[model samples]
Target: MTAADLALLDEEVTHCRACPRLVEWRERVAREKRAAFRDQTYWGRPVPGFGPADARILILGLAPAAHGANRTGRMFTGDRSGEVLYAALYRAGLATRPVSVSADDDLRLIGTRITAPVKCAPPANKPEPAERDNCAHWLRRELRDLAELKVVVTLGAFAWAAWWMALEPVYGVRPPTPRPRFGHGVVHQMPGLPAVLGSYHVSQQNTFTGRLTPAMLDDVFRQARSLAGEESRG
Candidate 1:
């Protein structure tokens, strides 16, 4: 598929309101306005994936943050989790910069893309099963369109599961029986499928509690780059 096709899919994603609860929650958060961002306008719509159409590395996240991507209109932007993620990407030579604050920023991904299964921000960062299914087609499209994709670095178990769910239809293969369990630094490889590398979510809850550190995240991306056959630039 061409970049224009991906762009069209992105446009469709932004206009989606298939899940009433997610639509209500995302809109409510936008309207309520977080105290720190009261002066800025909220995107309030479904956020689309970021990066090139031919990306070799795909970073799969759970969903957009209520005040982060929901306010900035870009996946993983304007949030602590984004800070950690982009920084690691930069270290891994996958991004142009170590920070991702806004969609309009000069930040860029190099042979890398980031997206989520659930497009809209959900209440308390939790997306319901029905909502996830509602948003699955978008992810399937993205997977189908990223023709050069070689690796999928899933952030947390939710994204790992979503990766398998989205992959089944795209590749016409079910996940291996017993399924590869999710764990930081875990790797799962199957013929005719992009390798899956698991990582802890870049949330403050993980970072602040000494569960996920810079070195750890960097290592995950290091492995991801290796799996993607990317040369080390860090």
Candidate 2:
């Protein structure tokens, strides 16, 4: 896939209004400003995935947080989860900074790209089955565009499922039966596709409960880097 194709897709994604439910909810949240970010203008539109077109590692998240990415217009920004996720990424040598505050934060990733299955923020942090299926088109297109990707780190079960499902259409292969389960540090290798590594989402629920710790995230990202390094050499 070429950079032009990814750029074109990014442009198209931002203007998408295919899912009415997502469209309504995202706009509603933007209109009713959060107390902490009352003075800031919210971006009530689909958030495009960001990173270099040739990145070898793809980080998948579930969806935008109502007051986080939906507010900052960048995935995993302006929120508690980003604080945890970026800190671990920095420690693993993937990110240049330990925090992601805004879309223009100048935080860079090495050999990695980040995206979400659902582009818009959903009410109550849950997207229905139809919304996911509709959004899968954008994700599959992205997977095809990231021609050099060799590893995928799914932030939760939803992301794990989305990544695996995308591979079938993006790479033209039927998945193995009894789909791989999600778990912290679980790795699944599929031929002609990026190896998928599962991690509990960097959400507050997981991080606060100690279900996903800094060490846990580091272990996953470290292995992801190693795998990407090997692919680059190959």
Candidate 3:
């Protein structure tokens, strides 16, 4: 609920070694070092959510990319996925810059936060269900701490499901029977909780294949702003 509390949680997330598999993978990648980034030091630890604690919108992703966030120590940064995502956020007036290149970059999110269900980057970009479960507590605590949260923009089916799962424990209410299906532009509202909006992840698979476009992503955030009662630009 407090800024200091969120900061403490973030620090705890970075030091976590809860799942052995994830711990090994993230560190291995950091030590091996990608060819292009060999000279740069890799974070090789859990990437905590970015943005202010009082943010009204939360953008949830699947997980960090081994060569992206795992290298930069910031969610959705240093990767093609971030390129697409941040650009769209800029178009929606939610981001101060359209590119997120490094953890120290001046880029900033306006009234929004970006995080992932799994804090560590898994091998092959796929995390086991056990790993996801192990990291669920972090997400739950983040949700409970974002006191002004009004909407969640889930970037894929995994994030959509994670949002639902994390909310029940925080709100002490179960999701409605027959949970809503996930798809681009889908919106579902739960009583006394922030509205959830679905969007195709900005991964290369989606953006390169035309499954997700800038305009589509822009519209999603536009809707999010409206849902949160924030002003929107054309």
Measured on C-alpha atoms, candidate 2 has an lDDT of: 0.90
Model 2: weakest 10-residue lDDT segment is 225-234
- For every model shown, the clashing-pair count is 0, 0, 0
If ranked by lDDT, best first, what sequence of candidates would result? Answer: 3, 1, 2
Candidate 2 error regions (>4 Å): 230-234
Q: lDDT scores for all predictions?
A: 0.93, 0.90, 0.93
| Shift in Å, residue 170, candidate 3 | 0.6
Tens digits of lDDT, candidate 3, 107-156 = 99999999999999999989999999999999999999999999999999
Per-residue CA lDDT of candidate 2, range 1-234, in tens? 788999999889999999999999999999998999999999989998978799999999999999999999989999999999889888877788999999998998877889999999998899999999999999999998999999999999999999878876888887778887888889988766789999999999999999988888888988898877743442
Those runs of model 3 whose alpha carbons end farther than 4 Å from true positions after fitting are 232-234
- Over 92-194, each residue of candidate 1 has an lDDT whose tens digit, in order, gives 8889999999999999999999999999999989999899998999999999999999999999999999998876799999898888899999999999789
Worst 10 residues of 1 by lDDT: 225-234
**What does the lDDT read for residue 127 in candidate 3?**
95
